[model samples]
Target: MGKPMVLFLCTGNSARSQMAEAFLRQHAGNKYDAHSAGLNPQGVHPLTIQVMKETGIDISGHQSKSLNQYLGKTSPKWVIFGCEKAEESCPHVWPFSLQSESWNLEDPVDFTGDELEQLMKFRFVRDQIEARILDWITENRIDSETEN
Candidate 1:
């Protein structure tokens, strides 16, 4: 058996995709491997780091990346679209090995104003995404037969 591969995607690869990547990695343990990318890469957002660290998930080392980087790579078993733009921009050329889903997360990059408000929203979205991933993983709970 092999590790299940999961890919999280977004337009900017800065916030939502990054969060999904961390959540899956932390929650899935050794049962899976995960990565994240975007249609148009930008540096990882600073706030993304702050909020995840609140829950002790350090994503500060993650850098934003483009989807083209994975074009020729092996397709993942699970591909999750974490942003609207990435959902719209995903190429239809992926091989049949992929099972995909979209969370349609609101990009926190658009969030502005007070620092307190921003942190609140960031944590809110992060927790929501984390809960969703936890539910999905639990619903598909793996047995020993599914282990590598």
Candidate 2:
């Protein structure tokens, strides 16, 4: 059997959800299978790749996916909504026996600013997602000693 799966959901698979997926995979790849998708699928944002690369985790190859792809498939152990839009829009009754939670993160892509300011916003959100994933791993006791 493989590690249990955890899916992160968001309005767009471009930033927050993608960051969560990468961070979780980096921190606990041996304990959980991290996946992410959006309700309205949009391609992964360039800023997402740039910010993640700064942290030494390259997400350049990651692709945005839709929630529909997993509808009839094996259910994930945990379904985490990375933003309010996803949590509010998601079905109230999930088909799988899974735990769900909302993180209510701001969308970095929605920010309006200069190039440097925009990059900073992306970095901030990226760091927050990484911290949250690390916290989740520790709180869940999901084998924190795993290597990348």
Candidate 3:
């Protein structure tokens, strides 16, 4: 059988959800198939690529996808909303029978600051997602070979 799937959702497929997807894949790619999508698909943010690169994970090839894409497809093992908007707006009856949860992370794109400050915010958000992924891996005993 193929690896179990984990889906991350957010307002835009640009930041938080993207970061979480990348972090999970890097840490537990061998154990789970990580994917991400948005309520309103906005392309992946450039800062996301930069911040992920800092952690040695390249999300540059990741694309913005809408939640509808997975509507009639395979059900993920876990569907995690990375932002409140996604959690609240998600459909009551999804096609999948997966477990769902919310992360309630602040949107880094909503941060208003200078270039350097904005970059720092992105990095902070990226680190936060990575930390959460690591915690989840340990708690679930994923047996990930990647070093955090």
Each candidate's TM vs. the true structure? 0.91, 0.92, 0.91
Task: Flag the better candidate by TM-score, 2 or 3.
Answer: 2
Query: What would the per-residue lDDT of candidate 2 be over residues 74-112, giving only the tens digit for each residue?
Result: 678788998888888875636673688889899999999
Cα RMSD of predicted structure 2: 3.0
Top of the candidates by TM-score: 2
lDDT of 3 by residue, 51-122 (tens): 899889887889999998887786787888898888888745354645777789889899999999999999
**Candidate 2, run of 10 with poorest lDDT:** 139-148
Q: lDDT tens digits, residues 14-51, model 1?
A: 88889888988898856777888988888888888999
Model 2: which residue pairs collide? none
The global C-alpha lDDT for each of the candidates, from Candidate 1 onward, is 0.82, 0.86, 0.84
* Off by more than 4 A, model 3: 91-96, 142-148
Of candidate 3, the 10-residue stretch with the lowest lDDT total is 139-148
Clashes per prediction?
Answer: 0, 0, 0
Model 3 local distance difference test score: 0.84
